[model samples]
Target: MSPDLKTSIVASLESAAAKAGLNLVSVTQGTGFNGQPTAVFELGLPRQESLGRSLNLELSDTFDFDKPDLLPEMTAHLAGEAKRLRNPRPDSYVTLGGLPLAFRKFQWPFHRSTSGADTYIVHGEIRLEDGREHGLHAKISASVTLTFAEIVPAMEQPYAETFIYNAVRKTVDMGQLEFLKSGNRQPVPVTTRYYSRWQKKFLFTETDDNERLRYLLSKVYWLSGVLGGSKPVWIADPRDSQYLNTGEADLLRMAGHEAGEGLMVLDGEFAAATPALMARAAEYQAMLEAALDFTKPKFNESMRSGQANM
Candidate 1:
């Protein structure tokens, strides 16, 4: 990419970030995991430098700088990203059972598995964030099968980010992933099983009205109440809506009901946890413990005997 085009992209992203109350710290060009050109956007809050994130966007070979609408489209996507980053623990998510996990260091632009598995893989780490200074985490190699890859519009960051993250969450929810303080990279297979061809959608997990309410409560409690110093968080994120197979309006309605029940305080599209919600801290803690135990690796008599011999 030419320096002029790079400047234009940075300027547009800066404007979008500012409008969303974020600072565009810098933009750097680097090589992606797939050996393609990548732009890394360093974003931070207005005066809080400690709280920030770096977003990696891979630029495909066929990218055209001359396209008149390209800049606008990229800017629109960055604006949405800015909005998402405004949430407390933007990279973190809560499981159905209340385990809060923070995904980090994901090498973007999926690459083919070198082991000849006929799958595209991206590496990342998911850490347990249970309001603790130190906790368990897993280095993951998440792979998408060829059939499942066809459903993805693009292999780039902006296009595949949501579904990929949701896949990791789903893997954890199904007890297919285990978190440890130290361990080898584990495999998370993203296959056609996650897709519904008839509905033309990616199905991660099934959640009901009561489950949705519990999810919202857990999100606010952990993200806002525990981690964010009681700041309000956006409750109707499209990503969460998609993960839950529900509409954004439905999430907003759920938040409204929770606010009426005094479990949370709503600020338009955002919600903050209340004392009533925090009162269930023990319940949420128990859920987290149970989930951790469920995901722990089990050893049979033979494996235990082998370990004893070693």
Candidate 2:
């Protein structure tokens, strides 16, 4: 583990403990077994002995406990994350996913050349049990921060924001319509109150537009369920991603993106969340309505005439 990762975990846990109305005693990140970085953050109870008793540990009944540190609750969240991190590494590989953005997948022009920067190869050596040396080679990684300071052309924020908002609105409207059509459920009810809340959340607040857009996009997923329809997208199937570097391709294709081109979307929990699914459903409804409306002239007259004849 990295020192930064450990530090981050400690900080997050401490904050969580504080919010849960628990007294935070100490958060420490230090070197652990095998000299790997580790963080051990625990909430300290005034009545330490009393808190320890509530836990379901093998020794929970063996001690007096004080605070109700939600170990079981925290452990549940960790289990999902750890499962993702330790999924059967069929190819014995792991990945730190990239920031989601639409991008063209570039092939290395040469054996080691890519659209990325040129970096020197790094080397390290490891000792085997027999005292033999095993050499480890590390290539320069793709660094995003290096380009952060580079000056770029100006963009029309107003026009771009308008276009995206219109696109997003179309999706939201669709989901809302679907909900109304269902005759029993709320279309997540985007009235002045709801729209105002969402409008401000995305426009006024210093929030990520992509997140808001995605949240709205997820409305379609929810709308489908409300209307009794579902698009079952797999969270992360091992069978689909069995081959090395294949998961990325599978993910992109499933989401209707190019096989090699990347896409950004929520993970398993986020996708399954009520709000996100609803947003997806809304987006889908918007798309369906838009297509239907576009070809309305061809069917509207017939529909009206058929109704009149009946």
Candidate 3:
């Protein structure tokens, strides 16, 4: 898409935001995963005292295929990510504060993707200091992409007012209102406090790793029930297991590790923990004798010859 198209869309979006009573904070342009142009708009409104909530409107033109059915692709991508995280090669290993913490036990309770939108849930856990662990729960959403083909037309009649308004409205309408009703404005600090206290309280517990995992899962499941108005079964179904593949579990584990690292970072405990985590990961990988699998793939001349052997 041309720069002109991007500019027009941004203008239209700003106008729409104004109509919707949202104050525009900033609008910046960047590149998407495939080098396609992207614009991010930061918007929010005053609630009670502090800046109520921050909302982001991200527009990208990274359309790889025209009207592509992204459901399977998104699921496959998550599956692949999970696999890599489960059995990360030495080089591909993720590090936080220089620590090579790994994630474990990934589960996807929900996933939905279309050409327009994508959303998924990831559940896992990461081991922390002194055999302590924490649950990693994420609900990620990749919003709809807006192409130049869309921008040009939107600049004309309706002027993208409906599109922009709906995009911003649905986000707030869905959960933000409920969150305000629950009277938890500063959720990040609240979550951090709970996590820090939990870690400190359990630091000296003699509970086994399995018991720790059970506790983490139980807490997350209960939280989900409270937030979602439905209790998720704590059991792992064989059919659900079928959705995952090799290495996906590894990614799930890595995600968990990342989650644990985030909590530590928030609590100011990660700096002192990195070196030991990296050492632990390296030693664990060495014990597995599976470090060679991370090596780069070699090109096969015979396969490229393409003489229809099959």
Candidate 4:
């Protein structure tokens, strides 16, 4: 399910990358307890010159990744997500070589590219001075190359799109990060609501989680209990049994939980004469009618026992 893993990683990475002037090139997922994933990403960019600037980022073999390094930090995040999917971490699954820098670098007098020109094709062997070894095995490297013309074109000016804002939103969503001091970005609140007629306290908000399934199961269980439970019954006399006193009868019949013949009992909270609650009264009324019917026959049958009154 490389595609599946790719889709999942890309979905997460693109969202994170977009706000940072980058985008996921691709993600390849493999199988195993902790199979390594290979993901490629492109910055929202025109393939630029020498994969632009290469700065010294430390990833010590003994640096205790426990210490903070941006690449490790970011990769760690990606790996955590992999863990969520029950997959292996990047370190465990794949051999991540030196991180490469891909961007544009203006040559000396930095002349931009000439587009749609029938004039002439310029050529030069451009080499990117990226990797170097400082004292004590400290490595500095540049893993990219680019043509000046390819990097910056004269016709179309490159506009800087900082992924800072979107990145901030994603970071805040993660909640692991306090706001980064990189640029202007604010955390937005996520609103979640839960409502069910079967239960009270139907609202829950989280700055962290939107527990949709929990609410769904709770509502489901409540409904199952109700639909599968015995109904409460309260009987009262029904004076007019025609078409449910028209609108009033209709409302009460519904509220009282009537099923053609029997009025339904209701929860105690909504026992007022509200249109819905009237059904309880209707159920009571049906019960009264039954009792009255029984008594009327009983009165007649009892005449033999009390013939003088009859």
Candidate 2: deviation at residue 261, Å? Answer: 27
Q: Indicate which candidate wins on TM-score.
A: 1
Candidate 1, residues 61-108, lDDT tens digits: the string is 334333453445455456656656667777787887788888888887
Per-residue CA lDDT of model 2 for 1-310, tens digit only, reads 4556545555555554444444445544433222333343334333542233111011111111122543443433233222322221111111111000110111111112134543211111111111113321111112112222121111111111211222223333332212111123111211122123333322212223343334323322332133213322333433223211234344433444311122224344212223334444445456544533442234467667786554
Give TM per candidate: 0.85, 0.18, 0.25, 0.17
Candidate scoring better on lDDT of 1 and 4: 1
The weakest ten consecutive residues by lDDT in model 3 span 186-195
lDDT of 4: 0.24
Residue 99, model 4: lDDT of 13
What tens digits encode model 3's per-residue C-alpha lDDT throughout 155-211? Answer: 211222122222222222222211111222211100111112433311111333343
Residue 96 shift from truth in candidate 4, angstroms: 27
C-alpha lDDT score of every prediction, in listed order: 0.78, 0.28, 0.30, 0.24
- Global fold similarity of model 4 (TM-score): 0.17
Name the lDDT of candidate 3.
0.30
Models, CA RMSD each? 4.0, 22.7, 20.4, 32.7
Ten-residue segment with the worst summed lDDT in candidate 2? 94-103
Question: Which lDDT tens digits does candidate 4 get at residues 213-274?
Answer: 22212111222122223322111111111101122233333444433222233443111122
Task: Compute the lDDT of residue 157 as modeled in candidate 2.
Answer: 18
